[model samples]
Target: MPLVEINFDGLVGPSHNYAGLSLGNLASASHGGDPSYPRAAALQGLGKMRHNLNLGLAQGFFAPLPRPNGAFLDALGLSGVEPAGEAERRLRAAAWSASAMWTANAATVSPAPDTADGRCHLTAANLVTMPHRSQEWPDTVRQLRLAFADTAHFAVHDAVPACFGDEGAANHMRMAAHHAAPGLEIFVYGRHTKDTGGGAFPARQHEQASRAVARLHGLNPAQALFVEQSAEAIAAGAFHNDVVAVANERVLFTHELAFADPEGTYAAIRAAQPEAEIVVVPASAVSLADAIASYLFNGQVLTLPGGAMGLVIPLEAWEHPRVRAYLDGLLASNGPIRKVLPVDVRQSMANGGGPACLRLRVVADPAAIDPRFLLDEARIALLESVVAAHWPEQIDPTDIGSAALARSVQAARAAVLEAAGLTELA
Candidate 1:
């Protein structure tokens, strides 16, 4: 059986709001307290899925976990306690966070071909870098178990210990000759505690955590390349590796400064995969500022049905003069990326997520995945209608603590789950 990369996108939860929770994320801080349009956000995501489906790419959906998470509050010793002070305010803010909508941080996946067990392995991310997001793993694991439950085809493991922060696929990249073949898995981390190449931004993924994941999947150390993320990139708001670099099959599209040592990193990747295609976008052509602002590298690079590659980017990229010109040049030339498709995901963009952030890439047979999580035209119609009818048009920061808002979010999620015949997950 032939294997292919399937994009499993997280349904933007109704709790989607801008509370400015993530310290390193530029968009989250810039748009803090802004009114969020949940209905529009979700529909935009579903539209992207539909577009991919029409393009004959395999697309999947990961259900949003119920929010206003009481468990998280209870762990912090705040649940069941009435709000009377700043601590309560902070706790409440964390409770209403829609951070889970960026499912790229959900888990680190080792496709069946890469793992020793021959079963695709996924370990939920601990996400300990941010307070609100730290609470996602438990629910994310539950959803993962349901979506990829076949023991013969999938192995869903618990998150790594909390002491070691793990941000999942956001910091991981893979490349192979083909989806089913053995490949190189690159885990990018920040500066080590002992090595003092510094930055103010937090390093979300720990090297120890990455090693733990590799061992859990029984991956050979030679095939697993652990590279340090450039402190410069982190300072520039490339908080995750996906922000600076992205890979599909044998090609690596990245900014020159994506790694601590560009020369060494490129050599290592090439050494691992002899036929690797590395496309480095120099800062001279498009400043790192423009790349970060436009999320140019966050675009999804897919091997289209016709054997050509397409870069599915956000509208922001097309609007940026420098980045747009660069993309146009690449297309005009005989580059690996043959086309550029711009998508509208302004709602997620406003909150610091782009096309890549919305999806988790899993290399597997579509038939091996649970049928309920896969999407079709009819399923998309049902999801779109549910979002249109039940999702809130706007959710303000002040609305985070509203009991009515919580109930509404739950109702909307339940409706979508029912529509997808995934009520068991609900």
Candidate 2:
């Protein structure tokens, strides 16, 4: 009955490029229109997966959602015919979107222990705030259904209605004594669709969306807690909850401005799990600007095999002086996070994602899940080889409309599908 938390990382899609699609994301806007190295990005992501696998953690992979989505274009009232105009250009942009690479937004997962059916449930995100990202849910739902298809162990639900924006696990967190234990489910919302309380940034995760997802999963209301994300964090570019906080097992590491009322939220979580540890980084020690810039809180505190914990962070944190000193102090002390490993996800980092943003945590009995989604040394090697040979080295924003680029991306995805024995997905 033991269940381990499995990290399902999104394979950086072959169309990975900077389109400056995210408005509130500082890095996304700052590095907009810059050329992106899709091959390098995918390889770095694969390397991270390999590192976790070596650490004796269960690792899973979600293939990039299909791009050049024609269905999306039709809905936008754009045709596929030639003699294309501005409308066609905009449509092609959505089709070539690689934002699907951030799988943390893929779905909100309710582990077997938290669900009424005693089965894990997943709801694909309806990323309605961003036009490019809004096109992802249908394809993401398809991918989720395929990856977690075992009905005996899993339930895959369609996204909530598009009227209410839902950003999935990026806005959800669960804290339990063990992966399989019934625990606290924290749903963080920024604004309601009708209420524009998000200050400077558009609040993507609606309270209604979170409530609907919890209802769909049949989560016990007593165990579920809904919280509003701080407008300060949102205005400061903490676009998602994972951007300001991350949780694993019994620990929740977050910044001071993560919630509207940090103290009250922490107390509720404590009431649920009296033994829960909440690590808050004071605003004076690290300003919200620096925290978002370095993505300090985005680091994952993974429980190693011997019960010790390690902090998996992006190289950006090591480069930030204040953040680096804080991390050093934590490791130097007798804290639960004993190890600090800096990974090179510079490509994703440049586009406003960090180590935490690349993954979706699914706590389940590995034996009960689909085997093809799991990865090992051999599969990692195969994925790396396929990416190097097929993924485009660089994709400029201008290249998003290129038919050749779109074809190359689809072909690269097909190669990965073939390697994973998921030709049906291809």
Candidate 3:
């Protein structure tokens, strides 16, 4: 009852709240001559910006939300943060400790003030899993704790080392057993024990996903749903925050993103609670129109909406006309819209996330929320890809033929190496 809204985009790592500025897990941040930190100071990247907007959506149902400081330019207070491990615990004993983390699939970065190639990125290891992965994302954990502390358990994929229930089949059992929430529950959707070990996705990824679900059992949730997110084929392409079936009002459907099983999602939700309202988020983040565009350029992507249904598209369709036009407008204007430009098309196509990925709605006190109201999702896309041909993200001019973007697939890959490590963990 305390959590009323969910944002897929807003679930990145936590150094700050959804309504707050993007922060990094200094422990996992890219060092070795990487300027991702300073760059993050000047310009909040599209992915990270979208994360802020997604968190803002929670304000509609939650009352008296404070306005976030748009400019966290000098806010690298991460001097004390640490990656999850023995050292991180040592640092947390005194004061702050990152509760949990979001594995980042898309990275939201910013350029250092007045610098072109120099940039900084604020991220978590929620979606990405590699060598540089984090055991927890301090920023995301903060938001989840503030918003979902009352829930039985928060959702996460268990594709990493040292994850909750991964020690055994009882791994799920082990995680659930350790959980403190009276009714905590996590939904493991993929091949936990499915392929035993060698499925299309690495065996570890499946085990980790299942362990995350298993970790939720201790809360003894009323029920948890599981589905096969990936088919026997491709790894990406099925993320969307389209329809969330509450106990069963109508089925909260998002206008921005969609899923392969929209109706099924609604059906499953209705089966649980017939009285829940099925509110439709037709205007949140990116719309069906944007989906159409991304479908063209970007092939497919993934999404996480807390426990709600999330949406995803591919980066291939980012070149669509409507997407570019709309995004260009966001960058051109100077207003609140610019602040959330990351949520629009800019981050949508560049990173694995879309507008729905950014932001979370905090419900510190249960009494403050309305329980059934939908939030506004007004955001314009930014097209930073126009100069994709230049360095920083240097693309070949011959390949671009005058239409250059800041990053190409290869460039983005190199730019966010730390993020890549996060994926390896998964």
Most accurate candidate by lDDT = 1
Which digits, one per residue and each the tens of the lDDT, describe model 3 over residues 198-288? 4333322243444343333222233343433222211223222211111111223223223234457446545554433343333234444
lDDT of candidates 1 onward, in order: 0.89, 0.88, 0.27
Give the CA lDDT, 0 to 100, for residue 328 in model 2. 81
Candidate 1 per-residue lDDT over residues 360-415, each given as its tens digit? 99988878888888888998888899999999999987787788998999999899
Better of 1 and 2 by lDDT: 1
TM-score for candidate 3, please give it.
0.36
- lDDT of each residue in 1-426, candidate 2, tens digit only: 588899999999998888777879999989888999999999999999999999999999998877777677677665455426754665567667778888899999999899999999999999999888998888788878887788998999999999999999999999989777898999999964246443667889999999999999999999999999988898899999998998888999899899999999999999999979888888888899999999987777899998988889999998899998888887887776789888999999999999988999998888877788999999999999999999999998778767798789889989988988888776
Q: Mark the 10 consecutive residues where model 2 has the least summed lDDT.
A: 191-200
After superposition, the stretches of candidate 2 with alpha carbons farther than 4 Å from their true spots are: 79-91, 192-198
Tell me how far the alpha carbon of residue 285 in candidate 3 is from the true structure, in angstroms, after superposition: 20
337 in model 2: Cα distance from truth in Å?
1.7
